[model samples]
Target: MRQLRRLVLMAVCSTLVVASPTRSLAREGVTQQVHEARQEGSVWTAFAFNRHLSPFSLNVDVEGSVATLTGTVENEVKRELAEQVALGIDGIETVDNRIRVDPGVRPRLVSVAAVDERLDDATVEARVKSKLLWNTRTEGLDIGVESREGLVTLSGESASAQARELAGKLAASTEGVERVDNAIRVTGEPGTVARAQSEVAQAGNLLGDAWITGRVKTRFLSSDNLGALDISVRTDEGVVHLAGTVATAAEKELAVETARNVRGVLDVQAASLKVAG
Candidate 1:
């Protein structure tokens, strides 16, 4: 009887030991499946938001850190674009692009909701407004900006004809703006300069030196005339310092004007900026 009882207890212990690891492994497998699903969802959402890849109904599959893309695009360029976008996502170490390049494959008509379209337009409008507010030439002017499908419309009042034209130029130069319809009326307002000064005074207290410097550098980077030029910008207490090499004297002058136009710039010291040989 004693031997039989000991044998039964040993069998039960052996069964429990084997079952524990099996249960643990089952849990681990589930966790891995969930992680891969989330990664796949992330890649799918990214493709949906991307302008170039959104039109195509691309399928994404993720395994561990690799994402596999399969779809049909109009050309090879778009197929490559899709791969690049997938690789851009975090945790996606590699992209296996199996997209077919069929010239006959037209982009599917992906119907974007009206709300999404409006959101895009709102983003463009905000960008234009920010550009105007940051620019010294257009800041403090009563300008209204609206955007729809990359078309920008400008209205309100300007103090001078030059201001009105500058507003238009700034809007046209913006990234999403396809065309600008400038309807700003020149009111010959006397307080334009004063209002500008007052706005700057208020901004001076809030705008840090680093913020001013960054804006100045960004302006240089975006300017077609200055983007290629090597320019260095620094700011201290609303005063900006510019240093770099420019090909021509006119370029140097334009650089100075650009720096001066940034809001919160109390003065510009450009003596260090020199013309190239």
Candidate 2:
């Protein structure tokens, strides 16, 4: 009976360990703790005190200690100061610095701040929309550009998924883009999502690409290092190339299918792709 009882206890322990969702719980707990530790009021006080920053020109929006700082500053230096102050506080979890700079500091910003510093609101919107329509990837054009203030808001439908995401990122990163409101949706083609999803992901991924191989492991399917892997993307010339060694033939087809969905892709070249694994 003693030995039997020990076996039963061991089985119960194993079951409990398996059933409990500890991995997910631990991640959530850590995120929550970070939020709790970073309180808003404390960050605000820090923002107010920093010599390089001033609360008078800053706006703070806080939720459960997470802070988003948005407003206008005179120049790039002041804009950075605002972020530094908010994050310097020990308990603050996050800081979003969305501040606009004066045109005097940078001519491009003078043409892009959301508030009209130069032209009428209607005129600004028209000009921005016209630009989007001209771009191949920005087919579904919904643009709101306040020329007087030079703040641009873009929304609409694109023929391809890659277009929608690239248009937004391009606008956001533009020299004249003071504030980019990306409302573009991915629709219009069969394989649209696949092509655009990867590129959109790459926009952020390329910044710190070394981190990806550690996280999203490559599952190769073929003998050739390049084959068996799936890669489909629209080139600058508007051609789609499907390359990679896959572990199986099914993966090769799936990769091709993924490329076919992108809007404005001339054609998917799958001859270069192979499957092995």
Candidate 3:
């Protein structure tokens, strides 16, 4: 019985999952027909997104090769990480971010309030503390005020946007504040919005500049002994390798010429082309 259980467990564990549709866009095919078939427009993305994801409350949506993600996450870093994984797919064009942030998400900014003690010493500390404490918005601000001569300096991390923005105003308005140096860092999390934009920009470069225009179409094309299925183009440096299908022997020759003439191309490998009657 023990031996049988062990064998069954091994059998179940050894099963390798293959052909998951989620990342299939990474598969290689150079022909126009192949690209058209493999290019998942919208439906495949929408159906596949929720199939696997983190258990967090953030919501992600997909439509027509564009993915839109929403909902709130506990931490800012998790929000950015999730977006990175989704954009790794080849076919994705855009990502719309509508995700809300948690309370902790507002702390990306830091504020340092400093004062020159040469103005007023004794009441300056009390006065700064009173001002900070009185402001309802700065409750989460970790404050430190120091006085030399007569100036009061304040420093702390603001809790939210309003807090960081108002730190200078709040400090300068205080009674004993003579010169306020507000060093609050306003850093919004590099969440989906920032990352998605960067990825789209990168993809634009890839689509625009690769040496091989990929199974390109030509005005007057020809070939020789080229198989229509051998559309794979391998490039040795700047030289293009043509593989796959062709309609006639003329097409094989035409393809090699077409590849040779493409801008920045060095040469062509038309060996894989097969022409038929």
Candidate 4:
């Protein structure tokens, strides 16, 4: 009986040893599948958020670090754009772009539930943040901006109540923003705003004139108070020239002030920015 018990114990140990490796292999396979699924999802989300690529029906497949794109676009430029966007995703080392460029292909109608409209939210957040950064009064304040749909929420610490109010105004002035929820706290800390401003100024000095011009244009485009397409922005050295037709004297004045506050702008020449009749 003792010998029989010993044999049974040995058999049990052998079974466990064999099952352990099989279980490990199964777990590894599942992990790999999950990783691939995540990669596919990331690629899909990137395509969905891009305005240029969103309208077209695109498909993404991922294996390991390689992403395969299959879709039909109107032109070759869009096909290349799809590939580049896929390459931008993290962990994607290679993109096999199998997209066909058929000039006759039309964009499919996407259902609202199928795609979350976070692109507009993202644009609103960026515009609000840029406005705050370009505004002299609120540029130095620690302001956190968040947007959901058209509603914007501001949170952070401010050195003064005026700064907090200014931050909210800047956010509200951004185009596409429907409401502003100002949650900024006033600390009344001396030199806090000044110190932050100094740091921002130092960083701004390193930016190129072209970069400054582009930023100014982007700000104008997102501003509710300005007509971006009507305005011409040109930066020379550190000076900005504005030649455009605005609705009122107040708008022209606002335009000048807006350009002047942008970092790296030494001066704004807006004599030619005439008010419309």
List clash counts for every candidate, in order: 1, 34, 46, 0
**Each candidate's TM vs. the true structure?**
0.35, 0.24, 0.24, 0.36
The reply for model 4, stretches above 4 Å from the true place, is: 1-19, 109-114, 117-277
**Residues 92-159, model 1: lDDT tens digits:** 89999999998898776554453245445544554566556644556657687778898999999988
| Residue runs of model 2 more than 4 Å from their true location after superposition | 1-38, 103-277
lDDT of 4 by residue, 9-69 (tens): 4564355458788634543543454455445555665676566888898887777888999
| lDDT by residue for model 2 (1-277), tens | 4345446545644554577767335434433432332233335434433435532345565555456887676678888877777776555567777778774532222211221222122233333433343333442333333322546676556666667666666555543456667666666662222122222222221112111111111112222343334453323323455555667787677666554554334456778776664
Candidate 4 worst ten-residue window by lDDT:
198-207
lDDT of each: 0.68, 0.45, 0.44, 0.68
Instruction: Identify the runs in model 3 with alpha carbons over 4 angstroms from their true place.
Output: 1-211, 215-230
Write the residue-wise lDDT of candidate 3 on 1-277 in tens digits.
Answer: 4345446534432331144343223222112212222222112222222212233444444445666777666666656655665576466567675666575643222111111111133234434543444344543356665545545465666555566656566566655467766665544322111112222222222221122332232212123333233465554445676777677776677677766776546567777776665
* Number of the candidate with higher lDDT, 2 or 4: 4
Give residue 175's error in model 1 in angstroms.
Answer: 41
What residue pairs clash in candidate 1, if any at all?
A: 136-261
Count backbone overlaps in model 2: 34
Comparing 3 and 4 on lDDT, the stronger one? 4
